[model samples]
Target: MRALRCPVVELRQYTLHPGQRDVLIDLFDQEFVETQEAVGMTVLGQFRDLDDPDRFVWLRGFDDMPRRADALESFYGGPVWHAHRDRANATMIDSDDVLLLRPASARGGFPAPPGARQAPGEPAASPPSLLLATIWYGHGPFDTPFVEFFERRVRPVLTEAGGEPLAYLRSEHAPNTFPALPVRMNEEVFVWFARFADEGRIDDHLNRLRHSAHWSEEVLPAVSQRWARTPQRLRLAPTERSVLR
Candidate 1:
C-alpha cells in the first residue's frame, strides 16, 4: 500500500481508565521517547491531572499528514499497541472523552484559559487550593539544542524553586475539530501547564525569569524560537474549575 499523506498535522488525546492508566503511562513514556526520535516527529510532551491519576494528556508534532496517518495504524495498530488501546476501546473509544485535539495554535496545554481567576481571598470551601498555571507556545525550530539547554539550565530553575510541572505539551494541526473545540484552533500549537501554591507564589514564579541571567541566555531564546512561529498563545487561570475529579 502507498503511504498516507496528511497535509496538515495531527493531535491525539488518549484517555485511560483508572486501572489502565498506570500501565499506559509507562507504555507512553517509552513510546513517546522513541517516537520523538523518528523523522518528521518533534516536541513530545505529556500532562496528568493533579486531582486524578486516571486522566492524562500528551502532545506530539509531525511535519506531514502522510506520516501522521501511517503513524495512527502504525503505532496503535501494531502488535504491542493493544496494551494501551484494548482496555480503553472496551469502554469509550468513540466517546467525546478520548480524542485528538487541534487548538487554534498548537499548544493545547492547560485548561484552555478560563480567563477569570478568583481574587486572592474568597469564602473558604473544602480543600482550598489555588491552581497556578503558565502555558508557553513553542516557536523555535531548534528542537535538539533547545531540549538540551532546557535540561541543563531552565529546568533546574523551575525544580529548584518548587514549581510542579504538570506537563509539557506539543501538537499538530487537525483538519477536523469537535463541537467542543473552537474552529479557529485548527493549527499547530505547543504548550505546557504547571501548578503553584497561590498568588504570591505565582507572582514569584514569573519573577524567576529575571533572576536567571544564565537561564535567559541559554534557555529563553531556545523556547522563543519555537514559540514565535506558532499562531496563538494561551495564558489563563480558572476562577472556578469543575475540578475534573
Candidate 2:
C-alpha cells in the first residue's frame, strides 16, 4: 500500500439546503480541488453521501498540524475563496460537522489512487466505486489499548472478510489552529474507511463478517462495551474529481 504523504486529515461533512447538493458539488469540483492543493494540502476525496441526499462529505490532508494551520490560513484568506465564499455558503445549512484525525497506525493513512484524478470538467466514472466510512464514537479518548485492539484484532477480520482497508484514523486532539473552520472538539471518535468495487461486494463482505464466529463472539462484544454510541456508517459514491476512488 502507498503511504499517505499528509499526516493531518480532516473528514468534512456538510449539510446543504435541499436540492442544492449538486450545485455546491459542481462549484467545489470546479473551484476548490486544485486551488486547495496549490495552497499546500491534498484533496483526498469528495463524495455524495448515499443516505443523505443533501449532505456532502470529503477529505483533505496536510503534512502536519503546523502546515495544516498555514494551509488553511492561506486558502481561506486567498482570493479564490473570497470570490466564491458567498456562493458556496449559500448552498449550505451547516458546514461545521468536521472531524480532525490522524492515522491510527503507521501505515493506516489513505494511499494514493491507482489512477490520476480527473481534471476540471471531466465526467465522473460510470457507476463509481463505493466507499464505506465507519465512525465509532467513544465516551472517552481512544486509549493505546483500543488502538492496539483495532490494529491487531479487528483489522485482520475486516481484511479477511473482503473489506479493502483504505485508512484507519483516530481523533486528533490538537487545538483547532484555524478556529474559523470548526471541528468536533468535544467528541472522541475512531474512524475507518474501506473501498469496494460495487454494492454487491459490500454486501458480501458484511455477510462474511456477520457470520464469522470470531467477529460475532469476540469482536462485537468488545466493541459494544467500549463504544459510546452506535457506530455511524456512511455509504458514499465518489464525485468525478475524488482521488480516493
Q: Point to the candidate with the largest TM-score.
A: 2
Best by lDDT: 2
lDDT tens readout by residue for model 2, 91-199: 9999999999998877788876677777887875544798999999998888788888988899898999998578889899899888989999888899999999888
RMSD each, Å? 14.3, 1.6
Error of 2 at 14 (Å): 0.5
Model 1 poorest 10 in a row by lDDT = 236-245
- Stretches off by above 4 angstroms in model 1 are 1-126, 138-153, 177-182, 229-241
For 66-137, candidate 1 gives per-residue lDDT tens digits of 565555545555554565555445432222332232222222222322233222244323333444334444
How far in Å is the alpha carbon of 45 misplaced in model 2? Answer: 0.2
Candidate 2: minimum summed lDDT over ten consecutive residues — where? 119-128
Q: Could you tell me the TM-score of candidate 1?
A: 0.40
